[model samples]
Target: MAFFTRLFRPARASERRFSELVGPHIETMYRMAWHWTRNTHDAEDLVQDVLIRIVNRLDELEAADKPQPWLIRVLYYRYVDLYRRRQRSPVLPAEDCAETGFAAEAESSVMDKPDRLALAAQLERALTSLSDDHRDVVLMHDLEGFTTAEIAGVFGISEGTVKSRLHRAREKLKGKLHGSF
Candidate 1:
């Protein structure tokens, strides 16, 4: 409607100053953050902080037509900084993990206390015991549903490298899961 247009008609002058145009990109940003952070609370906080920065720097961006790379670059830097900060801080125990939906499963537990349940829990335990880099690859590729290409972009690596890393990670996970099986 004309009313909506009028409300958003203020900053449409510059190609890069289109601040109101970010509404459609929030989900993608959150997905990127989630892929990087792995933890739900950290992902949500990272997305919110990135959005605030984007809003403040909307007019400063050199490329408006394709903001994805720029946005993702910010996310990558933030994630790295967050990683460093986490290393310097005390880690929370699993029992102390906030109910931030990180460990929640919405599916019905049709295999309650079944052999499959024990094996699955053992596999999860195995995964939680992997190195940080190995865990990151699995989380980004398998858990967060990101393509190898997108992960390469996030990690500033080539798609081939991403695939190789993912393959190695999978091999390790397979061993752990098979050991439990």
Candidate 2:
């Protein structure tokens, strides 16, 4: 009984510490997950997966200088893994799924403007056409405001590569939206 009690105490403490560190960021995690998944249920699952995976790494999370970036990096890798797994399985692609009405839920003033809405839809379609790497870089830098260096760190690539990918992605978008402007 003493041995079992000793074994379980640290696990419980670690879980408590993990919750303390991660609880405040749950909303942020969900938002980032939703941005990538664009589906409420999938986003929730993704955040839950990240939380479960990182709980065992409480030491690392506690020692990190910036927990938010660390959390985002973990989220990114998990998203990539899930993305690849879905690719291998014979299932409906995320894009083919029906819209989750996020766009409609946008600022009503913006939604009411047909021209802006059409342009937004065009841009989204063009984004979907890019390769995953390109799209991820573009979204991280242009949309999410992450620095190129930060993105490179997250992707485990060189900063130059991140810049190149961002540039190419923008060029591709421009080509796709040539007449829309």
Candidate 3:
């Protein structure tokens, strides 16, 4: 019995350590996934896929000094792969816009703040108009509060490229918003 217990103890310890490392970042992963997928179900699926990959590669990930960036990089790549696969598939007829429901909810919450709703709508339009790469940098750096260096790390690009993308994205956003207001 002691021998069996000793054999299982390391496995249990590793499981606990993996949980400790991953538990805190689940929400962050979900948020990033949500932004990429723009649908709750898809975002949840993406995060689950990421978590499964992380579990399978736990031995590899265990050695990283900071796992968050690495995990995010995994999430981003998974999303890109999924996006590519989706693009290759035959297109189905368009579904009703989910943003309508979100906008309705936002409208209800800000009944007394019409200006805020208009601003949010405008911003959403502006964001949607940008190319995916530009939107990603802007969302990660400006909305999600990731540093430029962190964004560079996640995208596996140089810091200067991240800065350039961010600058161009912001400039485009400014132009769009400037015209709207």
The lDDT leader among the candidates is 3
Ranking by TM-score: 3, 2, 1
User: Candidate 1: where is the Cα deviation over 4 Å?
Assistant: 1-40, 56-73, 86-120
Clashing pairs in 3: none
TM-score of each: 0.59, 0.73, 0.81
* Model 3 C-alpha lDDT versus the unseen true structure: 0.79
TM-score of 1: 0.59
Q: Return whichever of 2 and 3 wins on TM-score.
A: 3
Q: Write the per-residue lDDT of candidate 3 for residues 43-108, one digit (tens) a residue.
A: 778988887777868877778777877788899999999998888889853543664423554787
- Model 1 lDDT at residue 81: 88
Candidate 3 stretches greater than 4 Å from native? 1-12, 91-96, 100-108
Q: lDDT tens string, model 2, 1-181?
A: 2312232233577676876777666766676777788787788789878877987898899998767768889998999899889879987754626554445445366866888777667777788889988988887788667889888888899999999999999999999999777
lDDT of all predictions: 0.63, 0.77, 0.79
